[model samples]
Target: MAEGRSVSDMDVDDVIAMFPKIDPFLIRKWHYAFYTFFDLIGNNVIEWKDFQSLIDAIGAVRGEGSEDHVAAKVSLTKVWKSMTDTMKKDVEDEVKSTSSWKLHVHSSKPCDNRKTEKVLF
Candidate 1:
């Protein structure tokens, strides 16, 4: 791990060295996904505020107070809750660093088609 830098800040070789058991392709994919989806504020970590911003953006497009907006909020809230619960922490204190997020991704078995199908369904 690079001093004062998260895994997201590291190069491919650094990430591979940090997590040798994980696939390099998966790590690269995650690195892309993390920046593209999770890091809404351009920060290296994923926090509740980022999810709230996403929820707000979706609500704005769907129309706040509308059924679709409400449903989106509920669904996103559940997702946030699931993440925090998995880490055994409160929502306000929850912060998904690159290493922790990658570990969670690995534990979720992203390579398993059955699990992926279940999530998609």
Candidate 2:
């Protein structure tokens, strides 16, 4: 399931199915938001690496002390500041709506000879 395609060629529903607990609506919303925010439509799909990049970026801010984390946070902060008011509001609203959501990040541990990383939400 992890091979044979570039990250931008991954199917949305397939990725969503990987995390059963997260609200599909929320995932879909973020999918579209990321799509727009990252300008990922050139290939018409969001790949696994893209999703991992998002998680890493968020984790850099949310995770504890590390030089890499600090650097990622600084980069994200600059991008966040550069975002338009509407874009910021959209993100704020999405976050507010999912404030009560249960999200969990799982490592890409190998299982059955395959590596699957899950960011549950």
Candidate 3:
């Protein structure tokens, strides 16, 4: 060891001792292997274990009280409103055309009246 030089030049232990109040950072998925092989830790990152823990934690939160009901609640009010509109349109069309237009105007209602129906997209 050289005299009058900094501790970083002397040993790895001296360098680690300088910063003793920090948590080791985690890397997500493949980054864990990077940290392990490089003997290094990132400042702030999500490791694979952390992500899995998050997924498990979310599942645990969702499963509270009713473990059998694992259904994710989504707001389908918009979808239902659209369906109601479509149904209303169909009903109005049925009332207007009655079976008389079958011999005359035929398919011109702006809606696809095929039995299979079509997706707008």
Candidate 4:
């Protein structure tokens, strides 16, 4: 890991080296998704506050009390709920570590029968 950075901040090469058994492509995808979406505040961990940032951003653009903003909050809240449900842990009580996130990504199977991995990017 980079100096002063958490394991979540490790580059692709470091991640690949750490989990050599996992596919490199899948590792890259998971890393990309982690940084792009989960680590919204760049803290290297997934927390409710990160999701709140996304909700706040949507509210800023759509107007705080507007329908769109309210809808975004509702939708994101549901997403958070589903994620916590899947993990069987409360996000508000504990942050999701990057290692656990990686495991979750690795364990998930492609939703369809297509040979290609889903293109998240």
Superposed Cα deviation of residue 27, candidate 1 (Å)? 1.3
lDDT of 4 by residue, 32-116 (tens): 8778876898877877888899999988998997898899899778767766655666757444666666666566555421211
For residue 12, model 4's alpha carbon misses the true position, in angstroms, by 1.8
What TM-score does prediction 1 earn?
0.72
Query: Which of candidates 2 and 3 is the stronger one according to TM-score?
Result: 2
1 against 4, candidate with superior TM-score? 4
Residue 54, model 2, lDDT: 55
* Candidate 4 TM-score to native: 0.77
Query: Per-candidate TM vs. native?
Result: 0.72, 0.33, 0.18, 0.77
By lDDT: ranked, best first: 4, 1, 2, 3
Instruction: Please give, for residues 71-121, the per-residue lDDT of candidate 1 as tens digits.
Output: 878987876776666556688874577666666667764454334323323
Q: How far does residue 113 in candidate 3 sit from its true spot (Å)?
A: 5.2
Superposed model 3: Cα runs more than 4 Å off: 1-75, 89-121
lDDT of 3 by residue, 93-120 (tens): 2211111112111233546233212211
| Better-scoring candidate (lDDT), 2 or 3 | 2
Model 2 stretches with alpha carbons more than 4 Å out: 1-5, 40-77, 80-121
**Model 1 residue 64 distance off true place after TM-score fit, in angstroms:** 1.6
Backbone clash pairs for candidate 1 read none
